[model samples]
Target: MTPDLFGRHRAVLPDWLALYYEDPLEITHGEGRHVWDAAGNKYLDFFGGILTTMTAHALPEVAKAVGEQAGRILHSSTLYLNRPMVELAERVACLSGIPDARVFFTTSGTEANDTALLLATAYRRSNTILAMRNSYHGRSFSAVGVTGNRGWSPTSLSPLQTLYVHGGVRTRGPYAHLGDREFTDACVDDLKDLLGHTRAPAALIAEPVQGVGGFTSPPDGLYAAFREVLHERGILWIADEVQTGWGRTGEHFWGWQAHGQNGPPDIVTFAKGIGNGMSVGGVVARAEIMNCLDANSISTFGGTQVTMAAGLANLAYLLEHDLQGNARRVGGLLLERLRSVAARVPHVREVRGRGLMIGVELTRPGTDEAAPEAASAVLEEARAGGLLIGKGGGHDTSALRIAPPMSLTVAEAEEGAAILERALRSV
Candidate 1:
């Protein structure tokens, strides 16, 4: 059955739509932090469907809310009033640190980011955008224009003039040898130099943690320093928090808080966890910026009733249970354990990231060359050992990404870690 489905998928879906594993397993169902394949083998889910199953698999609160809302109504075009949408928007606006925040819902992170780009360009009246090196925004034409990673970026054609900047990756760049303070200063200097060469960019879009860039991130407060400079030039700071938002970083409820010395970002885009797997994404900005567009704009299915209900219930559960704290505690243990294991593995290049968003980069022993084969081996081995993880990196796709559900327990972490340890050693 799985083979038949795989053949059908390949026949219908685009070839570029990649799937994990040489022989992919059909995930039949999930509960808590675990999922079962069509063959009835259970695997501890570490990647959480690319960090989408944020709270847990089949969370009761979210499921109940979705069911109830679906019974009443599934969707209504943005032309009409929607109670769930308004309620969710209010909660999100209050949570967003931006002053006079306004929320505009979208169906995906790509659309949310596209909306942000639209706002920034329209408000600033500039099509130039500054993006960080080794960063990814989304797959849309506008979002891909600003993406710096070559692997994820399929084409060079873009609507916006994008300038790639330094300081996204802390380890493998020209300033890798410098201390955090020195590194931050050098990147700022580079930014100033870049600005001198180009038209005033409308905004700078960056991820607090580069998601598809193998969870890489710049030093804390690095953006704060950049903000001081960009603010002087009237350049907006857009935080792409699709993967790092909603307290996933543990220390802060939002990833931008790591660089919040000057205050919240001018615009923020979010998705990939808020709805606990439902298709919910949105942009939050000050009213002045959000309403800058003169022409009418609306997403027909953006803030639908069912998705909003799921988001509300999921968010309430996440806050009430303090899953962020859970992520911190369990993720800390997981990180420490993985680091301990990686210390003895020569192929393991680096172990980095915060909270549940951890990455283990693999390279050829004693060399900087990425070992994508080793990463593939580890992925397959881990899956065989009843663990499901993910892989991502700059160009070689050689990093193992471990972002389990935020509600991960210590025991589950330990179990996954042990399986991963065997996989690493096997590779």
Candidate 2:
């Protein structure tokens, strides 16, 4: 009754599905740092499924856990209690350092953020929420409403209650050409001015590292200072770790941790690697603040049996294997190699980000305008050379983001860097 796996169908895949993938590669299967297409040609995954793969693809332990959980149980109604769900909550809370905290789980980053928005607005009894410019929360109505990127603004603007404000940018090494201390101060001042002009904000959401804003790491003392400003105005600080969480940044378990003493976020949202490719996302809220939400607020698919099993296994694999330490060491080596290559290319403007979350910015030989064509050419060249990476920033100009799995080895990192360097030269 079923068609052959390789059999052609009269109906082709929907164009909407094609819209999600900008690249031409058709993935069939994946393993550690490698993906294969229908032709069975392998490509090294430097992008790590857009940084969602923390333990690498088809991780044996993670797969084993999922298999075992599938054999045992898969889903349950929210009205009933489940062991995997309960244990996952406890582990996530403990690791996140939110004591006695309540967790609301979802299936994606946007859903998690949307839930947070609902809870914040309902609990705080405020219709206004302030988000940083150049931010990207998600595509859903409420979550997209909070996003501040210009490209997404047209689709996001509506009767949705939200306010967009620019956050502190980066302008130095490891994070360059972004807003600095002066910018953060100005942002705070702007927020104060906004508060005076409009209603008190319910929440102030930001990415500790602005992943979509060209990997902009806020200036030193920025988050701590922002925390103070938000607290003074009785607004909660919501750290959107959708792209920066789950130890991808290395040296720290979460991106907010890199903010030093000033970056302790009040509420943190996480997805991507938490389930190691399973459908799962969650929020770890400060115990006191989380209590503001009423019991009526709940999600149906939150902490499904299979998803929790996968999350627990993924966290275990990361911790037991010291993936974070590996990322820190290998990422440093890779960055040094990139810097060495940049020294040869006059067009390479900067290299930024910490650990595995890195970005390479290319520019004109003597001007600030980026050569997007050159960057794209280099990307395609790298793909031809067997390295799969990603491009970011609004113009698609300079910023090339590289966020491989934490399990990537020193040797693999070197190989990826070497290929990237060669690709740059070819372009």
The CA lDDT of each predicted structure is: 0.95, 0.77
Q: 1-427, model 1: which lDDT tens digit per residue?
A: 2789999999999999998999988898999999999999999999998999999999999999999999999998899999999999999999999999999999999999999999999999999999999998899999999999999999999999999999999998899999999999999999999999999999999999999999999999999999999999999999999999998988889999999999999999999899899999999999999999999877899999999999999999999999999888888889999999999999999999889999999999999899999999999999999999999989599999999999999999999999999999998
Residue 347 deviation, candidate 2, in Å? 3.3
Q: TM per model? A: 0.99, 0.90
Q: What is the lDDT of candidate 2?
A: 0.77
Error of 2 at 86 (Å): 0.8
lDDT of 2 by residue, 292-400 (tens): 8666755678888999999999988888988888888888888888999989987787788878888888777777676777778778888889898887654453578
Model 2: pairs clashing at backbone N, Cα or C within 3 Å: 169-178, 169-179, 170-178, 170-179, 171-177
lDDT, candidate 1, residue 388?
99
Which stretches of model 1 miss by more than 4 angstroms? none
Task: Tell how far residue 331 is off in model 1, in angstroms.
Answer: 0.9
